[model samples]
Target: MLIRRAKQEDYCVFAAIEADCPGYPSWGANGFAAEETNRNSVTLAAEFEGAVAGFVNFWILRPQVQLNSLAVRGDMRRRGTAAALLGKTLEYARKNACTAVDLEVSELNSPAIAFYLKQGFEVVGKRPKFYNNTETALLMRKTL
Candidate 1:
């Protein structure tokens, strides 16, 4: 997989990936495009076999990196595409002198929770009704 900065053309693909992921809080293509104006945001696309397979969006906040979103195509899951995207995010965090990576995932998304746990993240807190005012959100963090 080739992980690189996401360009305008990749936004729709990212949005489509989000659409395929049920329960994901999607930031539509326009929302992804708008990130270009945010100095703190970094969006990346994972290209596999010449096709966009996944994407990750995060914010560099000096002492911390906040992972805003991540998703991989159903066929791309477990193929290291997601991991590669996340690995790049961690690499950026370390390069920026960030001490930790933080993110909140829907409590209902057990697969994501498991993935993060495998990536050395630990659940540190929770926000009730954080997802559409229905599902709780599990706040997880990995201290570098």
Candidate 2:
């Protein structure tokens, strides 16, 4: 897998990957396109065999990088695609001078929570009803 910063041309592929990943908070194509040009954001893509397979979008605050979304294609799960994307995002954050990285995972998404935990993220807090209806969010953070 090849990980690199995403360009505006990859928005369609990014949207499609996010659309197929069930647990993610969906965003419109235009929103992703806008992220590509955001000064404080980093959008990354994982390509395999010349096709986009996964992506991670993050926002760089002065002292922290907030991961906005991460998704791997349905057929590409369990193959290290997500991990590569995340690793690249963290590297980008570090290179850009971020002191920490944070993200919110839905409480009900056990798999994702486990993945985040294994990736060294610790739950720092919780937000009630942060997702749709009664779904809660686990605020996880990793000090860089």
Candidate 3:
């Protein structure tokens, strides 16, 4: 799997990946298009066999990185696509002198929680009803 910067043409596939994981918040094609104007935003796409397989978006806020969104195609899970994307994020963090990576995951998403834990993230807090004011959000952080 190859992880690289996302292009405008890849937004649709990114959106589809978001859809493949239900209950995950989505930034549709238009939303991703708007990210082009954010100087701090970094969006990455994972490619497998020449096809887009997943995506991750984050912001490099000096001293830290805020992981905003991440998703892998349902058929591509456990193939290291998500891990590669995250590895790139950590590379960016180290390059930028960031000290930590932060993100929030839906409390009900067990797979994601496990993934984050396995990736060295610790639950630092929680925001009740953070997801559509319905599901709780587990705030996790990895101190780099």
What TM-score number comes out for model 3? 0.98
TM-score of each predicted structure versus truth: 0.98, 0.94, 0.98
Local accuracy of candidate 1 as per-residue lDDT tens digits, 1-144? 899999999999999999999989999999999999999999999998899999999999989999999999998898888789999999999999999999999989989998999999999999999988999999999999
- Relative to the true structure, candidate 3 has a C-alpha RMSD (angstroms) of 0.6
Better of 1 and 3 by lDDT: 1
1-144 per-residue lDDT for model 3 (tens digits): 898999999999988878778778988998999999999999999999999999999999989899999999888899788889999999999999999999999999999999999999999999998999889999999999
Ranking by lDDT: 1, 3, 2
Q: List CA RMSD, all candidates.
A: 0.6, 1.3, 0.6
Relative to the true structure, how large is the alpha-carbon lDDT of every model?
0.95, 0.87, 0.93
Model 2, TM vs. native: 0.94
Q: Could you tell me the C-alpha RMSD of candidate 1 in Å? A: 0.6
**Candidate 1 wrongly placed segments (more than 4 Å):** none
- lDDT: the better of candidates 1 and 2: 1
Report the lDDT tens digits of candidate 2 across residue range 58-118: 9989689999998888888998888898888888788989989999999999989988999
Model 2 pairs whose backbones collide = none
